[model samples]
Target chain A: MRAVPRCVPCVLEIAVNTVERAVPEDRQKEAILAATERVSELYRMEPTPQPPRLGTEAQRTVMKYSEDPDPYREEKRRANERAAAVARELESDLENIEDPEELLKRAAAAAIVGNTIDFAVAGHEFDLDELREEISSAEFAVFDLKPEDLRGARVLYLCDNAGEIALDKLLIEVLVEELECDVVVAVRGGPIVNDATREDAEQVGITEICDVIDTGAEMLGLLATEVSEEFAEELSSADVVISKGQGNFESIPEEPFPDVPVYFLLRAKCEPVAEELGVEVGSNVALRWEPEDENVRRWREIVR
Target chain B: MRAVPRCVPCVLEIAVNTVERAVPEDRQKEAILAATERVSELYRMEPTPQPPRLGTEAQRTVMKYSEDPDPYREEKRRANERAAAVARELESDLENIEDPEELLKRAAAAAIVGNTIDFAVAGHEFDLDELREEISSAEFAVFDLKPEDLRGARVLYLCDNAGEIALDKLLIEVLVEELECDVVVAVRGGPIVNDATREDAEQVGITEICDVIDTGAEMLGLLATEVSEEFAEELSSADVVISKGQGNFESIPEEPFPDVPVYFLLRAKCEPVAEELGVEVGSNVALRWEPEDENVRRWREIVR
Candidate 1:
């Protein structure tokens, strides 16, 4: 979705959160304001970018000013370790679930729970109890597309934040073993925010499961124009794509996705995203937004 | 009192609110971002200025980019009209009280209630019921100082927002008619945010009640060095100075304040101001921060 004026402040907020991790408290504001100066120049340009893209620019600018290359490296490592311990506990719990669809839905919720590791998006507060509540109570808005929908389907699974990818492995396992789909999980090429990369994928043992590849992206998610030819080919050839978080929800091209049934699995975290999706803030959803979906049909009619 | 990192986001919020009223919805974000770019440059300077100063710069930058001076002109007029009506209602409610001290405290509460007219500080929601609740329910943190504090003493009442000055007239009436102090109300020289100017003071009938003068400041409040010589003289010579809003509370020099007790009457709206003052957010305060006061003494001891 295009940015509104409220998005400008959030850009600076993300910058402050990034710079604070790298610099002393005294220098944090200075570094953030410097980054703000750079990110703001893009505001005048046509075709406004999404929050994650603007956030990526903000993070880059802070890195340049504060001279800290990988500010979130330590935090990401800690988060992955924590996520692994929880993932193991969850893996045992999934063993009792007989239904494959139930297991897949639970696993999808686990992946959404993992998306909260994003420092640039959600602030640095993680409550496992709240996560448990959300997992138990949160219902997917559109979960009607059955496992039969993925019969012999080429599934491209998009990953978001770092530690969260450990949980995503459970969903990927369900996709491959139960749904019987050939799944390829795509991670980011570079370290930006807390988004996972090839190294993180290897660390989390995601490389051991299905085919794993990096999008060669320098930012949080894959913009259609910026990804490598291999990644683009994987995207186009996929029969069903599962988008992970708000980063992918925002970064994916608005025009090209109707042919492929892209199932967006995310929690609507911010106002703009929530408003665009016609959901309340803090909504957990496995939204099916194909060209044929009722909402997308309305969107097409409105656009026309 | 100092600008914290969270204050960074608020600066843009105020800018967005200001620019959106003047420009079309499409251009609002661009105008606010342009303003943010200019405001961020000021962060590199030392003895970092308060939020009001940065806010002044943001508003100035928006005006320059949007090519509209005094964007808040209509809002200010509306606020003044609303404030005048409220002042009339409050004036009658306060008439029943015979004791000057009781009346003055009520007037002080009225003044504090009026301070919410500021779009730069308070978000754009004006509910008369809420204002009435605040006026009645709010108690002074430091209400011990009697009208005797201004007895035979020159009083300088530093005005904040435009519409709020009508309420300031009530307090000035108490000072002049009861306390018998020569009172001067200082306002801004030029339009910045909704900060009161000489014109607003006159429009709100403050000039008819007490002496009204401009500080010759283009910003919200006076920096000691930035004000006119006359304003500086008035500031230095005033026996009991009543400063309105967080803008004045923050703009006042941290040191050199013990010589004359400056009564800071404001709501601790934002986190930084609340944190610095050791008060809860949304606390209505008649805070007297004399260097000799027990709290100030402890603060100095702890600071040292």
Candidate 2:
């Protein structure tokens, strides 16, 4: 979806967060000022871009100012380690559930819980200590496409953050083994915030079960114009797309996926996203949006 | 103080609020988009103006885009009426306090409670029903300047919001009748946000006790270069300045007031303002700052 006015401040704040990590203390003030200036320039240009595009540009500007390629390198590592421990703890619990449908719902809920590990979104706070309790009791605001919908389907999973991807592996396992679905997962081409890469997928053991491909874009979300030929091919061929987190939730709708049924799993962390998905700000959402879904009609009207 | 990264989102949000009120329903999206674009342009300018300055420009841009001179006219009127009722109810309670100092502190606290009536600041929510209870038990974070400091002094009170000014009258009454001080009140020269104007002062019975002058600028805060000659003369001669609300609290220190002992009486509404005051966000402060006070030295280092 195209950006509403609320996105400008959040986009800039995310830039500031990145700058604090990338630049040293003494030069941080100068670097942040320049980064914000460039952000303002980008906003004022003709035909204002989507928020994800703006967010990517702001991150790029900060990196350029500080001459740092990956500001979130250390943070990503720590997040992955934390996510692994939580996933391992959750593995035994999943093994106990008898019904395949209940196990699939529980796994999806756990993956949605993992979306809370993100650090780039402004004013979003997460505590790993609460993850277990949250996963057990999570309620999806929109749960249209179910376990039966993905049964024996060709599925493509879009990963969001580093630590969050580990929990996503649980849902992928459910799809490949329990539901008899052919699953492939895609990470970003390079680092942008804490978004998963090939390294993250390998670290989280996502590569061991299914194929992993990079989107060939360093943006917050996978833009149709920026993704590699392989990713585009994979995206078009998939019968079902399990788009993870807020970024992919936003960018995926911009593409022409008339026949592909996409299930959006995320914690609605911001106002605009929550409003678009018809949920409260902090609600966990597992929405199904496609050409036939009601939200697609509303979204088309909004962007137009 | 200069604008921080956190201020950009709030400033834009405030602008959006203004645009929603100022523009027609069908045309709101176009107006809001243009207003935000202009706000970005303002942020990109040289020297990077303070958040208050940026806020003023954003409001003006929305008004200009919609061709509406005062979108807040009805809201300001309602605020003044509500404030008057609250003030009338508070008069008897304030009259019962026996000690002069205790009465002064209670009255100041009541006036600070009135600062919550503001609507222009982003994410600021105020409930008028709780005004009485909040004023009764309000505690000051910094209460350095006492009644003795203002006794028989030529006090200049800088007013903030419309409904807020009615409560401000409680403190002004304390200054004029109880403390035997020569009092002068200053409102904004023109309507900006819901800030008190000459009409607001007259509506709230402020004209009955003392002289009321305007700052001669339509900006969110008073600038030294923007005030009338009469205001400049009165500002130079005042023994103590009771600066009200966040806007004045921000702009008063930007001046070269080496000798003027300014008592800032307002709730710390935003983080940057709260950080500059060495207080927690949402704390009620009645701080005395001059060249001699500790905060002035710290503020000089910040603004430099």
The estimated TM-scores of all candidates read 0.70, 0.81
Interface RMSD of each: 1.6, 3.6
Q: Which ten residues in a row have the lowest lDDT in candidate 2 chain B?
A: B295-304
Each prediction's Cα lDDT score? 0.74, 0.79
Tens digits of per-residue lDDT for model 2, A1-304? 7776567667777877776677776565566556666666666555566678878888887777665787787777777777788899898889999887779778989898887755434444556447777887888787765778889999989898998888999999989988899998999999888889999999988999999998888988866667777887787688988888898877777654435778888889988899888899989888887755554454334333
| TM-score, model 1 to reference | 0.70
Candidate 1 achieves a global lDDT of: 0.74
True contacts kept of each: 0.85, 0.38
Candidate 1 on A51-76: residue-level lDDT in tens?
66677787777777665667777777
Could you give the CAPRI-style class of model 1? medium
